[model samples]
Target: PLKVFNSEQIRNIGVGGHSGSGKTSLMETMLFAMGETTRIGATEQGNTISDYNEDEIERQVSINTSILHGEWKHTKLNMIDTPGFSDFYGDVVSGMRAADFMMIVVSAADGVQVGTERVRQMADRYHLPRFYVINKLDRENVDFDKVYHELRERFGKKLAIAQFPAESGPNFTTVIDVIKQKAYKYAHDKSGKVTEEAIPGNLQSQVNKIRNELVETVAESDDTLLETYFEAGELTEAQLLDGFKSAINRQMIVPVVGVSATANVGVHSLMDFIVEYMPDPTRRPAIEQDGATRKPSDSDPLSALVFKTVSEAHVGELSLVKVFSGILKTGDEVYNPGSSKSERIGQIFLLNGKNKKNIDQLHAGDIGALVKLKSTHTGNTLCQKGKEFELPPIEFPEPLISVAVVAKAKGDEDKIGAGLHTLHEEDPTFLVRYDGELKQTIASGQGELHLD
Candidate 1:
């Protein structure tokens, strides 16, 4: 029988990065490896989960955030793969809000780019724990040491490598797991599996230095560990693992893992790190306010934050949410503090791209969807009857591009307005306004492509 884990303790892994830096491709490989999808969706073909938008298909990029779920070795991984381009920054902002941990994707050859800096700033704003994955190490002319040094200089010393590339560029074959002191080799194919191997003979010294550094960092977490370290000179494996988890939960360390997501190299190891080191919802501290508090507990007064909204063909309207406290079940009556009214929890489902799995109750830490919630829009609050609590709303980027969209078909102006409103309902950043001076329906997004 397959074991089931509660949604309350599952990890919300957010994958964010620069466009063409392989964010979508990495998610595709992850889903494929976990048997979530029978085949991987390549960005070149425009079938990846995060790039499901029609325009994204033609442009071969992600236009909005896409949700995908998979089970990795008994841990449920609810991965939110977000668009990389600034044009769809709203999706990135919403993704960051819904996630408990972030995995920032950076290209090995490109080093640190503008998108990386932008996403990092967003992460900093929310005080979110982030893990950086240097992607595409299999490509040539990529200097691992130089890129690593530059990242440290640019991002700061708090950025440390948990896994280092054993060899880089075309000869990239394996990664030395800095914490484990083991090397993991990959299949020649992009979607292949990994094999455990001994640390490369030449890189053993470098690996030892990094491992010692990681151990020392972990040891600094507690007084007892610090004392033990001074007496013993080194921490045992079990002690190191415990200390690492504690350090990660406290945001004392941001671990770096290397991966060639296209070649499936280092992906599994990365997944292991996420499930093992990343903080789950239960571990996250509750947001406390004067009138309301949200802890990862079902017994607490029900309070869920609306982080995203989307318009679908047959579904009408969908509200994407993260339950910070209590349980939300179908037919449950909840208070929408944003609208100052009560709304019934219709159907709850786990969303994966366009596909959804109907579920009964969404626990804290889990990201799911509610169908046709009346009066509850994006950035709203839902709580138990008579208990009012409003979590902070997600901050979206300003629209930098605008265009006038007219109803091409005559006698459908009302329909066009309604359609645009529905679209805006799903995407908060999608602004639809009537330009009285110009007598046109003006829509604004982050860029020209975003308007389209």
Candidate 2:
């Protein structure tokens, strides 16, 4: 039986960071922990679920945003793994549109880099609630404390440590979860199995201090908790948990967790924190237009936005959409306000990287891919006829570099032009234009690598 998730049960999270920050590795560990995969996949080995593209595997980097889904603690999480390079930032923008929250991954050794700051700003632009995951804790010369302080100083005091390494480098096996007041030690075998243990005696004092700070910050989110704290000078674990979740949803507290993705240390704790604290899609504010707001509800009129289009060798073009208002089922007719054309919905699929699962329907706030749409492109709005509403299109940055493309074969002009058009459909950030004055076809993108 296929499990269907309601809007409130769905958590759409965008995972992003700078290149080599281990974003793909973290996702692979997550999928493994969730029982979605039998073993952890490595990016270096080109076997990661998210980096399935040939270009990405060959380059050992992600060039496009990949969507992966898993069930954690009875909650459905749609993880949007995005490219870290600025050259493919268009995919990042598209990923953000479909995500309800952002998980900013940072390398412990690298701290905050250019790509980290870019993703931070993108979270702000999208108004998505965000948290941080400091990855690569097992790397030599990595300073978790230094990176943690840097993130706090750069991002703001709102950034709070939710979990910290029990030890650094080769001994990095345990993480003390401040929120749950528990310690989890990962086996050295990288099997992702964690055993609960008491907080180490040496780290107890630090844990107490950090937990107090976390409770205080969470208490500030609600008046009742604040009053209780003032009276009792502390909060119970239950109260703190409730308050922390509220604070996280409102962006009042940005929790940070440390992990060694390759070693599988702290990955389970990180996934649990996400399932426990991250906001569900419905918790986000409603989408507004012309002083009107559209709440996520199956009873509301149908409204969805197409955020990505992928041209596959066998499937042609797949338009990935996020339902923001009502239920969308297979074989239903919908109208695209952007193209002003009516099209029948064909097969709907729930994406797990390149693997698609046939699903009968998707509720509001759920993301699914629609197959063989006639005229839909990225950022197009689809809805029931006469209930038309257009979402603001995703704003992609202007190309940073341009080059003239020439066809080597004499009769390959039309083929070149058609191929360029198809590529443009896949990536809106890449643009193609015919310069009449220069009599040359111009191709522009974020960088030379992107244009190539």
Cα error, residue 286 of model 2, in Å, equals: 0.7
lDDT of 2 by residue, 184-219 (tens): 999999998889999988888999999888888888
**Residue lDDT tens for model 1, 305-420:** 88888788888878888888888888999998789899988888887788888888877677788988878888898988877888887777788888898888998999999888
Residue ranges of candidate 2 with Cα displaced over 4 Å? 222-224
RMSD of each: 2.1, 1.3
218, model 2: CA deviation in Å?
Answer: 1.7
Global Cα lDDT for candidate 2: 0.90
> Pick by lDDT: which candidate is best?
2
What does candidate 2 score on TM? 0.97
Q: For each candidate, give its TM-score against the true structure.
A: 0.94, 0.97
